[model samples]
Target: MKINIFKNIFENRFSFYRQQGRRQRSRHSQKKERKIGKLKDEIIGLRRRYEKVKKLKRQLQHANLDSPEVKTQRIFQGHKDSSHVRKALQCHFAVLGAVKHKYRGLKNTKSKQSLAQLVSDKLIKKYKCKTYCKKLIGCVSRRKIKRKLA
Candidate 1:
């Protein structure tokens, strides 16, 4: 009977140690899985960036230098002077505000065009700058009004 009690105690201790080892192994596996997940996410981000670079390179190789799109892109790239951009933005905002106030509650297409033309002419006459095109003014004003409504 004493021998049986000793055996039972030993078995119980052995089982407890085995359970502790299993718990530790599971925790280690979970940590490894988290690390693998992070690495996979990082790899995916790198692949996306690599693909974007490759696509841009392909586009550059196939681009037609004489095309209007290329010409416009070149022109825009060349006109990256901060002062000129700032002046243009200021003019755009001024025209936007004036159109907004003058044509309050007017949503008709004809009215929009008339307001744009009026703003274009006024800016040109006042600022003596031909940068503000009538069509551009019309589109910008329309977009702003649309945003306000939305």
Candidate 2:
């Protein structure tokens, strides 16, 4: 913390001028200095905010890696809203089994998709998972998607 002796001397001189009833206005450069100081303060504030955000990002990337939540985060990445889809799948399998027994003598397998679709439709309204319901049609026909989902 270096003190400017010239600044103190000029301030004392200004006070003395005020006391002597002789007004002494600051130089025109004072306005420019004030604007520059305000700009410096704003720059410092911006740098501090940027550093704080960067520190938080670094902490999240490196330090939070050992946290249990971080470890388990990827475990549930694909399961965001798939509970209803899984339930509908189970209902489809169950309804399939029941329909197979009821139509043991007939060969009406094309209509089986309708039962699964009905289950998916009803479960979507109940679970409010239309975003996930799109996968219903895929899982109904594609064995690979069902394998991945299950």
Candidate 3:
């Protein structure tokens, strides 16, 4: 019956440390899972953005860019006359409704205040409102054309 006192002490200490190590490992795994979740969210965002850009390209592809004379015509400011685009964008976005309410609140209305509700909400304000927006230039041009005589 040879009992080593030093070995017993070391075993007890090591067991405690091992238990602590398990907790640390659990924390580390949780952190890793959070990072993975974030990455997945970012990838989803990128995919949505890619889809939006692809859609814009597809729409632009319908343009007759080779001819300058065909630049400004009718039916959506010479862009395209098709209204079917709503079927595509309406899922992740509010189509025309997301614009004025993308930022802040709609004030006394439904948005969160009827907002949220974004792009595919982020890109709409930054890009779509300016470049790909519907009735933007068209409205301006139409306003100019129909202006009252001074």
Candidate 4:
């Protein structure tokens, strides 16, 4: 009789734990969903602010802050905001070329950072270019690639 009673108790406890596990999992997912929604809202807010700034920059150019004809014409030709996105769009072809340039040489290198350093080093050696600027670009591009892969 005692053995039967112990078996019954263990079965009840196991069943209770299974139900609790389900509840915990459901609550955790709900929390994740809420956090994701909050992040989405924050991104939307940032994009809106970026657009507003771009618009103001356009208006400033039109108001003739500099030479009227020159400013107006230059603004549309990819000199409007000076933001990352603007730089990216303006220099898309250049960056594409750079990417290709980097890719062709990355295969022999052991690590990405080393590969980037080599590129910057090579550019500096070949062109006598600005080391600081080229190094910064190399580091940033390497980080972007790492983040994208992750």
Candidate 5:
């Protein structure tokens, strides 16, 4: 019978490779955990913003629509009347709340971008924009008004 020294060495080397493969997998899993932690941090920040928007919406809803202070706000907004502006603000707040609720657990950038597009579409619909330029102009005009007031 021949002594098979080479076969014994090959078997040992194969076992070493298997152990190294398991170590590599564990290291890869650790990296995935770190990425998940980063995503969790991002989610936390988004949730904070979501809470703030929600609180603002609630405050706006409970506000007295016919008060003297609110009347001044209506004049500067360029809408035909306070009621119309209030409705518009309420509609946008609802849309934003929906977006925040739907995207609360989403971690991907593409999903966030899609949510932003959805919000923009809702804004255009609420404002009754006939064209994209008109919507853009409204945003610019609002900023200009804000700057003048400042």
Candidate 6:
């Protein structure tokens, strides 16, 4: 009779522990499912936002190609501003004045051409002048200086 009573107590304790473990597992699983649901909602929201941005990008790509602003930008891409042109011309004249002072008696056609080529090269390479070198050469060759000695 005492052995049967001990067995009954042990079975009752084991069953109680088993029910407690099952309850803890169910609670953990519920918490995990709640977190998964929140994550799924966030993913859906991000996908919608991505789709909207992609649509806008496609629209902009198509619209930009036919825009007048783009055409104007292309037309004026390499042309310097008027202020830059003025500054470059001023620098060119200053250099030319110095060259004239150094070579007061330079009169021959070959010597003038050589001097023009030299000036053009220097102005383009060193001074960062945007004017074409050939045009500069022509201008230099045609310039006349009045020398007091000659």
The model with the greatest TM-score is: 1
lDDT of 4 by residue, 16-107 (tens): 99999999999999999999999999999999999999999998777833332333346567445645544333343333444566668776
Kindly give the stretch of ten consecutive residues in candidate 5 with the minimal lDDT sum. 129-138
TM-score-superior candidate, 1 or 3: 1
Q: For residues 34-114, could you state the per-residue lDDT of candidate 1 as single tens digits?
A: 999999999999999999999999998998674333444555675665666655654554565456655674566577456
Where model 2 places Cα greater than 4 Å from the true spot, the runs are: 1-27, 63-150
Q: Find the 10 residues in a row with the least total lDDT in model 4.
A: 64-73
- After TM-score superposition, what is the CA distance of residue 57 in candidate 2 from its true location, in Å? 1.3
Residue by residue across 1-150, what tens digits does model 2's lDDT show? 136888888899989878665332454467778999999999999999999999999887777453333434445566665654455554444444444544564465656655455444543444444434455444444676689999
State the TM-score for model 3: 0.39
Cα lDDT tens digits, model 5, 37-147, are 999999999999999999999998899774434545665576566665565554444455445655774677676456445545544464443244334334334567899
Q: What stretches of model 6 exceed 4 Å from their correct place?
A: 64-150
Candidate 5 scores a C-alpha RMSD against the true structure in Å of 21.3
Q: Model 3, range 1-150, lDDT digits (tens) per residue?
A: 246888898899999999999999999999999999999999999999999999999978897552212322322363554444432333223334455445445445554423334434554554344333344323233356678543
lDDT (CA) per prediction: 0.67, 0.58, 0.55, 0.61, 0.64, 0.63
The TM-scores of all predictions, comma-separated, are: 0.44, 0.27, 0.39, 0.40, 0.39, 0.40
Order the numbered candidates by lDDT, best leading. Answer: 1, 5, 6, 4, 2, 3
Candidate 6 residue lDDT tens string, 92-118 = 554564466446645655665565555
Error of 5 at 63 (Å): 1.0
Clashes of 1: 0
